[model samples]
Target: MPVRAVVVFLNLLLLFFLGPSMAWASNGPAEPPRPALTVSVQQVDFVEMERILSATGNIRPWQDASVSVQTTGLRLKAVFADVGDVVQAGQLLAEFDDTIIRTEIDQTRAAIIQAQASLEQATQNAKRIRRLMGSGAVSQQEADQILAAEKINQAQLASAQAALLGQEQRLAYTRLLAPYDGVVSAKSAILGAVYSPGQELFHLIVQNKLQWEASVSSRHLSELETGTKAILHVGEGVVEGTVRQQSPALNEQTRQAIVYVDLVPSPLVKAGMFVRGDFKLGTREVIVLPRQALVLRDGFYYVFVLEENNRVALRKIDIGQSLPDGVEVLSGLVAGDTIVVKGARFLEDGDTVRVAQVAADTVPGMASVTASGAAFARAGQ
Candidate 1:
């Protein structure tokens, strides 16, 4: 009977300890597993966008003419041509005194005349001797001597004539004349001032035509073609031109190619002024996205777009030409697809997103619904 009481007491103690644990385990109905998290997302819609290739360059002369002196150490007699002067071809700009040259020519001409008179006398004697020989009145050796003397006199006359011709040609070089019809943009020659050979006296630019010369990177050179249109923005006005010349080689210093665009005749544009321009290579439909929507990670571009069933899908995009305002998605995107422009880069793929309502004017209804659904999924999760 004592054993029985002990066993009953042990059983009571065990029940006391186990009873609370069982009650605690049963407390609060088993909670169902929390739903997967949802992230709000939005889609990108396609729209018409202008695709352009842009560069900057400087305004320059259509043609530059440098009036250079041909001879050295000659004093300029008159320098009537100045900057802004209209000049025609063959118009005299300056002249050196031709007194010395004229004197030399006259002396040479007198020498030539004297040689000619002597030659005439030698020829007459040779003819008289030859006629006497033919009549058997003169010896053959005497006739030959007279003919030789006449030849020598003729050579002297020819030498004198050549000297006179040389002096006259040198005199002609004393006057500097306009090589082309152009406006003088610069002048350095002064009256009575000496100019060296190849010294520039005046700089001229073709008055009617203008060119926008821009240096472009070699990477952009392949797209260049004759007749390509370029738009130059100088200050507030726009200068439109067409590509008339493209260099086949790159510049040695900058490794850039020089491109020339012919502008419409306008007085407002001036040479040597820097300007920005856009060259249109060609046009193709591109997927345009707001710049804010893109995220750069690990040297790659990414975007998050909302999918049906409230799932946010992360996408890697290949970016193309990006302007100041937006970026162009060259690959991994298509038309009619929705991309989240706002708060897209902040979220991850497969994460539920809450999309705020955008105004109808701001975004299309279809895109907003897709965004809202993703957000609702995230909230429920």
Candidate 2:
């Protein structure tokens, strides 16, 4: 009896240690157990999205005209335009003292008159001398001297007339006129300061036109072209613009090119204001997933791809442009791949997940599932 009891106890100990192994071997490997955290799964889809390039730039005038004096040595008498004043083409912006110019012009005109009278007298003398040249009534040397005097007087008249015209033009320069319709951005003209030739008096924003000069990377130069649409973020509002031109050469130091975008004149925008812009290259089809699906690990982006048997596998993906709707997956994912959108942070590689809802077109009750997933995401957050 004692031997039988000891055998029964040993049998019970063996069963306790090896019974579960025997059962597991008979049933084959048991399926993976699900995690406690419930998650939402979504299938990636190819959606048409606007491809945009983001860049920062400055606002400037479409045409900046420097208003300067063409003539010199005149005292500024009056300034009719100030900074921020709008003037039309041919409108007088300032005036110089015309007293000296007019006096010089008058002197030149008088000199011309004297020269003309002397030239007439010389012509008559030369004619008489030519008539007497062969008759010996006048010496050859005397006739030659008469002809030379006539030529000299004619040259003097021409010089004097040219001087008179120059003086007249200088007189006109005393009245400074707006070269075109523009808003005066800067003014340097004083009430009595004498201006020198080519001295800048005012800076004009031609036609009050503004433009955005964006410095973009040279890599994207091929994508941007003339007439490309861009949106600018201005103060408290947004402005639409069109690409007008691109720099022919890249900056040697920065490897950046200047993209000139013409902007409609707006009160909120001003020259030299730094702003942000988005260039719309065009539309393209790309696979996109919601932001919640992305997980950052060790500075790289990853997503939890749902596999068969409700198991999740960690996948590293390359990302591109990020939009309000979702993030663009450049690689490591494809359409029809199911990814964990919520509770991704709670998962590990090969973790079995309880998908409370699946977001897909073919799935029935998709609206309800999406709503529930949104609520679950909110709760998880």
Candidate 3:
């Protein structure tokens, strides 16, 4: 072949092979496409939270009283009080049959009247005897006898008066009265049932006062003090209480002490109710994130943090209290760090994500991130 023709063909072949590669060198590599998953972001923020210690306990009355009668061998005529009734101190609760007691009182009163009359007559006779002794109309021995009879009459009158007072007290015992203002907790007196002395007929919760007695481990006892605030879970609601006292000694077997919390009066609270409560020890400032932002994988908690270029970086976080507001982030996060709140479970470390604007009404203490609606739609698809 001719030299000129061969040179031309080699140049053409080189151009053909290297043309596309040379053109690609003029432009940078194509930008990477955004990830398809859509996610809402929330900024970590500081929240003032209360330090709480949880404990379980039961509700009980602060003071209990057993109402009974001192008189024995009496049949109950009427029971005016029943369980769950609120009564004032000295309120009539029941009555015993007082027919025999009233009769005895009347007879003693009659005897006292007779004794008083006889004593009056003896006093007049003693005065006459003194006058007669001076006139020699009566001997010294007879005068002494007359004075002694007057003394005997005075002693008899005193005895009759004492009997009358005893009968009156016995009559008063026929009625049972409340010892204090309280709620009736139990009743044992039946209509027409005979009662014995000191036998309990009614049980009362004094002043309707109740306390929550919680068994707290000795380790946490020091953290609590009188007037410490606590909240009790009562049914579907909660009741506030204050630490009124603590047991000085711990249980020998359990090594736990009783913390008595005086609860605010609520109709829902009742003695003998088992309940759970949390004591508010103090407050602290902590970083927290929405619970949905966390992903649990292989027994570990992780979150997808927004990094530069709309990429996500997976971070392992130590979580503390899981509050109703948010999950407390103990470590691996800071104030003002953006994290994926929604759709975090579908992401991996270093994954490019299409950031979507969360609703304007975000969690308290969190800032909202904004993005184009078209990008959000494409990411959703």
TM-score against native, each model: 0.73, 0.84, 0.66
Clashing pairs in 2: none
As a whole number from 0 to 100, the lDDT of residue 275 in candidate 1 is 80
Q: C-alpha displacement of 171 in model 3, angstroms? A: 4.9
Higher-lDDT candidate of 2 and 3: 3
Model 2 poorest 10 in a row by lDDT: 372-381
RMSD of candidate 3 to the truth, in angstroms, is 8.8
lDDT of 3 by residue, 1-381 (tens): 999999999999999999999998878688797785877776666767888888998999999999887897878999999999999999999999998888888888898899889899999999999878789888999899889989999999999899889878888888888989999999998898887788999999999999999999999999999999999998899999999999999999999999999989999898999999999999998887778888999999999988877889999999987788677889998876778877898888888887665545444433345553222211111
Candidate no. 1 TM-score: 0.73
lDDT for each residue of candidate 2 in 1-381, tens digit (9 for 90 to 100)? 699999999999999999999998998966667475788776666778889999999998888888889888778889899999999999999988889878888888899999999999999999999888899888999999999999999999999999888888888888889998999999988888987899999999999999999999999989998899999988679899999999899999999999999997778898989999899998998887778789999999999987866789999999999898778999999876778877998788988877775434444212123432332121111
Query: Quick one: ranking by TM-score, best first?
Result: 2, 1, 3
Q: What is the lDDT of residue 237 in candidate 1?
A: 84
- Measured by TM-score, how close is model 3 to the native structure? 0.66
Provide the global lDDT of candidate 2 against the true structure.
0.85
How would you encode candidate 1's per-residue C-alpha lDDT over 1-381 as one tens digit per residue? 699999999999999999998998899589743324432233444545656777778787888888788765567777768787888988887787777778889899899989999999999998888778777787788889899999999999999999987888778878878888888888888888877788888888866367887888998777888899888887788878899988778889999988989998666688778888888776765566667778788999988766665456788999988866578888887755566666666666776555555444454322444332432211101
Instruction: Give candidate 2's TM-score.
Output: 0.84
